[model samples]
Target chain A: PGLQMSQQQINPTRILVLLNMVTKDDLTDSDEYADILDDIREECRKYGNVESLQIPRPLPDLDVPGVGKVFVEFSSVDSAMTAAKAIGGRTFAGRVTISSYLDESKYFAGQFQ
Target chain B: EPQEGKRRKRSRFGEENIAERNLIGAQTVLPSNMTPLQQQCYILHLRIEDANMRLRTGRFGYSDDPSKRSPSPEPVYNGEGKRLNTREYRYRKKYEDDRHEAIQEMIKLNPNYHVPPDYRPPVQKLED
Candidate 1:
């Protein structure tokens, strides 16, 4: 079972999904949110060109999907994969970040909530 | 009486299963393309993550005592070079000192583990 789980690694894609990097409170504050986005972009751009970046913010009285998660779309799969390896397990906002590649189609369909 | 025994056995098995999962989760296989140095760094990264998990879940010593944990390090400015207020600084500082300590321990474990270069150095610090 452990072997199977290890083998189930997701394929590399142009979009990288980062988890555990932010909290709900961080996203709610407008200034903090912008700061986080800039911080992530500056860090990610070191690996390659970042085409688009998104950090889903929480909504009032609504359960927003993907809140506190960061999505970064790079110009190429290689860049995305590189960024994933570099950023994974790295600390952001004092939290260990877990990163994975996301499918381009799903990213485009706005399903990344 | 037999049913009670079976229920207790199942619960024990469940606990063991969870422990096994955690073991596997902590030492995931390193990527094949990495060099020996990169692999060592990756393992250190895993150690850092494990330490963070322990601190977060309060599984170990210092984690159990909130007052014993190290105070927050000085706040670094944001990407745009703006300083963060005290409240914001403390809020972001949580777990940072712990993470830094873990990284230091990891470096001690493997002297070959090269620390990644800091891409964003604090501009204010440099100016000072």
Candidate 2:
């Protein structure tokens, strides 16, 4: 699939992660949010070579925008799993409601195959 | 009388029943005489299938076809800057105001101005 491969080319293989979208009390710029993604990318790089990382930002219109959510992406299945296992539900910005994600369908579907 | 091309049948059992038995499995039709393991497996499969069909459609949304993962972040009054540091509010406010006005201009020129909600700018809702 072009979508999957392009993301992979940017950074091959991907596991999706959902994280706390709590705004930092310190960052202040369009680029500042970009920095959060960069931090996530750096964290991902710890487990293995990271090709790319994405964090989904919610719209400002949604009254609940500040803590809406963010998505973290990883390059390897194993790395993503490790990241999810090691850090899911860990505190972020003094909040502990964050979540780790995975490509669940791919893993679950494989069970039947 | 046997129909043409029909196999001779000395027993009560026949081919059509065999086909149905193959399709639905023999124990379904012959439940009265099922082995315990066969009955248990059949029951379990039925229960599992019932559970599976109810899986929310959104869960299977990501197809191998690709071209997905697009989330439109609405232009906000310093929303991103608000994330970085709440102080960049004024600059973000000006920028977002400009972005919305630009979108309004496009709406004026293009009859197809009805953008998908996700693609639209964040507008303040007035109280009644």
Candidate 3:
């Protein structure tokens, strides 16, 4: 009974991973990337206080996997959860956006810390 | 007396089955039975869970399947079909090299490096 109760009580996470938000070409120019980030951040801010935001810029050398994903950390888990639902299947940067909660440990990993 | 005992046994079994049914009904709702809007929300919940599972398991760099998008121009190569030794190439190479070193340094300051794993390398076709 206690174990079941604990499982049911799991809380939402405070980070969101926005996939395919921008492409490599979109990130090639620093100024353009910054502008894109600003646009994303502005849209994300509508859902909650964004604690941090990250978008990877893979160098031309390495075939860095998962390049166009965006991570947004919010002030509260509830807000992040709400934002993930609200953003699902919505169009962003001319592509359908697919977002999910970043696992707390993964959010703290070498990326998006 | 034997007949009475069998009836009592059947009644006890029936009560147990009803109790079990109630227990099941008391548990969380099932997604399959949800209304259309609720089902949609449930699916979104499952997708978020799936995404989180991939992230938490150190599967970031390897697992993402990106959607189709226009290919970006490839890095400029030389006329000899080799990566150019042009100033632009050197500059980009230097920047790329330093970027990782800077990331390491930043990690020392704030242990969580901001290298989110959502970058999908552009696919290249083999020329005939």
Clashes per prediction?
A: 0, 5, 9
Off by over 4 Å in 1: A1-5, B1-128
Sequence-dependent TM-score of model 1: 0.51
The per-residue C-alpha lDDT of model 2 at residue A104 equals 42
**Which portions of model 2 miss their true places by more than 4 Å?**
A1-13, A21-29, A60-67, A102-113, B1-128
Candidate 1 lDDT, tens digit per residue, A1-113? Answer: 21112443456788888765777888888977777877788888999999999888888998876676688999998898888767764556444466665668878887764
Steric clash pairs (candidate 2): A11-A51, A27-B84, A27-B85, A28-B84, A28-B85
After the best TM-score superposition of candidate 1, give how far the Cα of residue B74 lies from its true spot, in angstroms: 12
Query: Isolated chain A: TM-score per model?
Result: 0.91, 0.54, 0.80
Best by TM-score: 1
| lDDT value, residue B88 of candidate 3 | 39
Expressed as tens digits, the lDDT of each residue in B8-38 for candidate 2 is 3221111122112222222211112334343
Tell me candidate 3's interface RMSD.
19.8
TM-scores, each model vs. reference: 0.51, 0.31, 0.42
Q: Which ten residues in a row have the lowest lDDT in candidate 2 chain A?
A: A1-10
Indicate the TM-score of model 2.
0.31
Which CAPRI level is candidate 1? incorrect
- Please give the distance, in angstroms, between residue B76's alpha carbon in candidate 3 and its true position after superposition: 29
User: Which is better, 1 or 3, measured by DockQ?
Assistant: 3
lDDT per residue for candidate 3 within A47-84, as digits (tens), equals 99999988878788877544667788899987776776
Colliding pairs, model 3: A66-B118, A66-B119, A66-B120, A67-B118, A67-B119, A67-B120, A68-B118, A68-B119, A69-B118
